[model samples]
Target: MVTRIAKCTCGQLQITVEGEPLGVGVCHCFACQSRTGSVFAALAAFGPGYRVTGRATDYVRTGDQGAKFRFRFCPVCGTNLFHTEEGEDNRSVGVAVGAFADPDFPPPRDSVYDCRRHRWVQLPEGITVYDKDPE
Candidate 1:
């Protein structure tokens, strides 16, 4: 199994993910835009049990679909880290690519929320595009 390890700016926090990501994408929804403070939010989805170290601050918000999403960030530098479904039973986690210490991370496999994407943002060709999360 391939695993990637990431360390936060303070060096006190560590995140480790086993195996390649299940999926990678960017979200252009208003909520994602606001949370990321950018036109879109990029994420790498991983299976359950990925390990995260150090203390993280969490913020929970309800999506337009009424599903609750929880975001976890480094408390010190306020760097967005990962997001997860609200309930403890949920098994997937989405890690922010920007938080990776490696400079050679792969690009996203898809882009989502095109309906809310800015007119100036141009996505690469052939990648999957979705008005919202893929059905």
Candidate 2:
């Protein structure tokens, strides 16, 4: 099993997860863009086999489809390190792929909300593209 460490810019918050992510994807929703200050947000999802360290601040928001998410960020640096879907029984978590700062980190396998994706932005080949979040 491979272990990965993702941390905030200020190093105040971190998460350690064992093994590869269940899925890696990118989101182009306006909310994601706003949260990341980028055209899109890339994240890796992990199961319960993970541990979190340090302190973080939470900002809860509802998605377009009405699913609520609790985004966690470093209090010192305000780095949006991770987020979790609310009302779900599973303890799955989505960690910002950029937080790892690993140049070789895996590319996103899925792309959501392509309608909102920037016109100049092009995804890699062989990726699953969705006009919107799949139901």
Candidate 3:
């Protein structure tokens, strides 16, 4: 019954998520870092229980698994809001955790691509981490 609201920087996009997120995690993959323009990317998984309103543009990429990753961002402000993998249906989206603008929303419970993580950046202790993606 937890509902969270996320928005694009310029307010052109808004995503409202109902219920708890399936999971929260951090990614250190090169692609994530580049796409987010940060050392790492934090994501919250919402399973088909969210609604998105407003206009956003999309960019697509091929994942290592050959899955299509479609990124949605606000065209007006160029803020990357959320993304979905191919065949996921409307049932799921991996949202940029920061978009909520809530400092206490939640911390990542998993860390992926640790090998690619920047040396100076330390992850929270005692969660879960994978040298690469989880097996």
Candidate 4:
């Protein structure tokens, strides 16, 4: 029953994750890399009970999954806060692992789009990996 709080760099937007995440994963897809300005994007998925408050701006993008994802970010500091997929439960949310800024937060359970992962990047042993989304 660990409760975690994730906020934008400016702390204008915040997300409260109740309990543990349903899943955590890293995305190595080009889109994710570009969005995060990094080699990959780590995300923590909270269940339907999570709560997010504060101002955010969002844009829709079609993911490789063929589903549209509404990506939300903090308007003040331009931090990627959370996103929800089309046809998915609105209450369920995915937030940036960096936002939590907590070393104790859960680690990614798997790596997706591993085919696109950088050659020098090493992942932890035994964690499940997929060339693409497990879905």
Question: Which of the numbered candidates is closest to the native, going by highest lDDT?
Answer: 2
For model 1, the superposed segments whose C-alpha errors exceed 4 Å read: 88-90
lDDT of residue 15 for candidate 1: 76
**For each candidate, how many residue pairs have backbone atoms clashing (under 3 Å)?**
0, 0, 1, 0
Extract clashing residue pairs from model 4: none
How much lDDT does candidate 2 score?
Answer: 0.94
Please, what is the whole-model Cα lDDT of each candidate in the order they appear? Answer: 0.84, 0.94, 0.90, 0.89
For model 1, residues 1-135, the per-residue Cα lDDT tens digits are 988876666756667899888988989999889888999998898888799889998899987777788888788987778888877575788888877866678778899889999989988777799898764
lDDT of each residue in 1-135, candidate 4, tens digit only: 888999999999998888888898899999999999999999998887777889999989998769899999999999998999878855688989999988877778899999999989999877899998888
lDDT of 2 at 112: 97
Candidate 3: Cα lDDT at 78: 92
Q: Model 3, which residues run further than 4 Å from truth?
A: none
Write model 3 residue lDDT over 1-135, tens digit each, in one string: 788999998898999988888899999999999999999999999888678999989999987667798899999999999998878756589999999999988889999999999999988878798998864
**Model 1: lDDT to the true structure:** 0.84
Candidate 3: residue 42 Cα off by (Å): 0.5
Distance from true position, residue 114, model 4, in Å? 0.7
Local accuracy of candidate 2 as per-residue lDDT tens digits, 1-135: 899999999898999988888999999999999999999999999999789999989999999889999999999999999999998888899999988889998899999999999999989999999999996
